[model samples]
Target: MEIVQVLHMNGGSGDTSYATNSILQKQVITKAKPVVIGSISDLYTTNPSPCLRVADLGCSSGPNTLLVITEIIEAIDEICHQLNHNTPEFQVFLNDLPSNDFNAIFKTLPAFYEQLRKEKGEKFGPCSIMGIPGSFYERLFPTATIDFLHSSYSLQWLSQVPPMVEINKGNIYLARMSPPSVLQAYTDQFRKDFSLFLRLRSNEITPTGRMVLTLLGKKSEGPFGKECYFWELLSKSLNDLVSEGLIEEAKVDSFNLPFYMPSRKEVEAIVCGEGSFYLDGLEIFDINWDGSDDDDNKKFKFDRFISGQKVAKLIRAVTEPLIAYHFGDAVIDVLFNRYMEYVSDHLSKEEGKFVNFVISLKRK
Candidate 1:
């Protein structure tokens, strides 16, 4: 099998720095505990490799990344307790682009180490850890080295620019409808990127190693245009800014979408075609960015930030810089304000959104 490294350059999720960190702190320690438990149980029962040598492939240099990794470790430890198995040694490979903020990871590790001491007491063990900088869709681990692989709120980014988006050429979307060409362009690139991921990992992963991917995706089909609500709402805001002269038209033109979200079919097709992995499980649920409108609910339910079904807000932070770069500072403020308002309006019209999916696969 071929080996390659895929650059995780999307800055994690689309959330701003503060929001991203907060969400990570909340979700990883609490919400994902169960998921990680289930994932490990599935691995032990179904996978040939079971020692918990896990690699977080798209780990950005951020608190949230650490939070997730730490939680996964805790979950595994708890599971082993119930099962009465000797806690297996764990090696956590924190990966990202070469330019990631390694300082953040190093700075926080000591504190995390202290926290682990508090939790585990005399049983404390060094988290066999290292920072590996590179891409995942390309070469990553040594041949047959990794036992379990995981990535969250990543993998939605295309490894390269979505094909056929040349600047000199005409608009990729032939009309306001966003057209079929654009969809196919994004689809083909997603397939190519994902296929490379499977091929690259196939050799290193044990015959039945486990992998989990949690990422954002759209339900719509057509390209980014009037029909897709996300595209329409954002584009209108940008167009409104253009009309007000808040930003230059060239800035908008230069700004291309750095990532693409694939539908379930597109994702399934790509994985199935690879022939090295099989879908062990998949879940797609609704997520809404809008806070619940019920006044009584808002006082407490929304304040704590946990929702029965809420989209991952951290993903929004990762895109804020890109949003500011494209739309200008003034435009971004107006845009996000309008976005929240739009979410409210959308909730009024169609109800809330969701995080949508959690997919697990096992190598075959």
Candidate 2:
């Protein structure tokens, strides 16, 4: 698949839109707040300036994109206050693929700036927010232009579907049923994409600049862990549609997700091997599938708030566009409805967990 053209979160603020259903991604940004603050803090420690250059890679359009920008600026403001330094004018770049809903982001900027001026005073003179549309796997800015770089919940997406995936049939992602070769293909793709990412960022960032990245990752060596079941059930749901003759089996055979959740070891090896940056800090944590809405007090219980429908909607919001692009719109609702039932049934058996990796890095 050509991921740059096909991959984007469901757009606009509707029930099934990514803007409305990205609570989980928002929580991820929150979880990475400390790393982000530290990166900014370390950035200004050596290169204190009246102007700052920052970029948020894979910044899909929505409130979350702006929220991340606002938080970074706030962190910088607080750090400058603590260091007795002057607050810097900001030049922020919001980047994603060309097809991303940048218009949505632009529409919110006037109000965002107005709110910023009201809070930070008119003396917060010159802050420029520019939208840059491109894949982060390559260079997007001039050399040594960026002071800080941040990407959250986006790196896990491979630049494209693995080349060998045609040999692995009937699975949408790397799952328990996928053969060893399929897993190896995914691992290889991630290694290549991530290495390129580091190389590009190393070029764009100043010597003292730092970056914080939060993405889905695995603790175990095996691909099939807690979150694999989500895909397993989703695959089952799609198979059910095929069984009903709602869609062709060939369509399913050709479909595969351009995503990979790397293990901590795998991540460490790639970053170390890339030789562009050194890992400043690394952390791995677990979050519930439904944005950590699990009520441990009622583990055996099930409710609408933590229902399969919610999880299915979240997945649909992020994935429907891609699936529809390949499978046609007629089956979109039916596919997700079946997925909801499967998710509900599976969640009833066990609470779903997603492992996330948050790493802080500095350019060499």
Candidate 3:
């Protein structure tokens, strides 16, 4: 539950004016439709009166959470309309770690509420929104009360210290590549975190509730998940620095990521381990793959490979904490700037990397 909350050049947060809401809106709305429907299908029936409670676990501050809540509600509204029933009065609970900035989220609520009220959506009902901040690895809401749960780019976070990481030794949390010791520790942490998640939710989710999750996962045999390439590179780079006495080994050893990425098998096992949920449907797809042309066939002419500074900002926002934790805080910016250069160089030689994953689990 304890995580090092450090910030550097990073993307936006709801709390910060980074416009994460826009990024989240773009990222989640498109990919979440299927899972949203799947979750709704589990609990919705052809009844005139609709009663549903949905939770967005690890819902970060600002626009992303609010946008996702809307997308999910709209999906449910479609289902309700298809069955030809009055829309339900929905209660949406957005939860995250206490460290997350809820004040910003609350500040945006009136606008979000007003926006929803003004828009004539397919799902037209008074939505009750509340902020519940806490750890998802532990207890969440009341027993047998939740109808749907959704977590995105979250769950991959490990629950505790990775077992194989020895603080005493110089290795710290850097996953070993050949033997996969660090990876094993990370996997174990995920297993523990996920088990706790399911157990906690088992008490809260109704008999036929559904949960949809998306996390960065790996298809590579590499030590880090494909989604975590930057982190892996950063870790190894620091270790290299330690080997050369350019940086302190002690500093490198002191660092670890509270978050991680999981494999499809790893995720499936977590849901199955609970025994209360079934994998009704699943999907794995690439996101942000820099195609020769964008989805709308809009060609971005970046003389550099990464296209724009926005991509740079995103990686910086997400990786600065990890970078600063290992290397001196002094070099965090330099490290990512170097990484961006490499990204440009590499993309010129080859296409940029792709992120893949599975989204699953439908309760019976």
Candidate number with the higher TM-score (1 or 3): 3
Q: After superposition, how far is residue 273 of candidate 3 from its true place, in Å?
A: 2.8
Q: What tens-digit string does per-residue lDDT give for candidate 1 at 1-364? A: 0112223223432344533434433443344445555776677645423356778876776656676677667766776688775566667888776756656677777887788778877564456678888878678778877777877766766676565544412121223544466656766877888889888888777665778777666566544422235544555555566667886666655444546666777778788888888887777654334334355455764432243113223324455555654455565556656555554455455545434447788888
Clashes per model (N, Cα, C within 3 A) = 29, 0, 6
Better of 1 and 2 by TM-score: 2
* TM-score against truth, every candidate: 0.78, 0.96, 0.82
Error (Å) of candidate 3 at residue 289 is 6.0
Worst lDDT window (10 residues) for model 3? 7-16
Cα lDDT listed for each candidate? 0.60, 0.86, 0.63
How big is the positional error of residue 279 in model 3, measured in Å on the Cα after superposition? 1.0
Per-residue CA lDDT of model 3 for 247-278, tens digit only, reads 77777676676666666777777778777778
Which pairs in model 3 have colliding backbones? 9-316, 9-317, 10-316, 10-317, 11-317, 12-18
Candidate 1 ranges with C-alpha deviation above 4 Å:
1-35, 45-51, 165-176, 219-228, 290-316, 324-341, 344-350
lDDT top scorer = 2
Residue-wise lDDT of candidate 2 within 1-364, one digit each (tens)? 6788989999999889999888888878887887788778777777787889889998997779887788878887787778776789999999999989999999999999999999887876378999999999878999999989999999999999888834566788877778888888898999999999999999899888899999998788766766567887888888898899998998887888999888888899999999999999899877777775455536765564456777898899889989999989999999998888888777777778888999999899
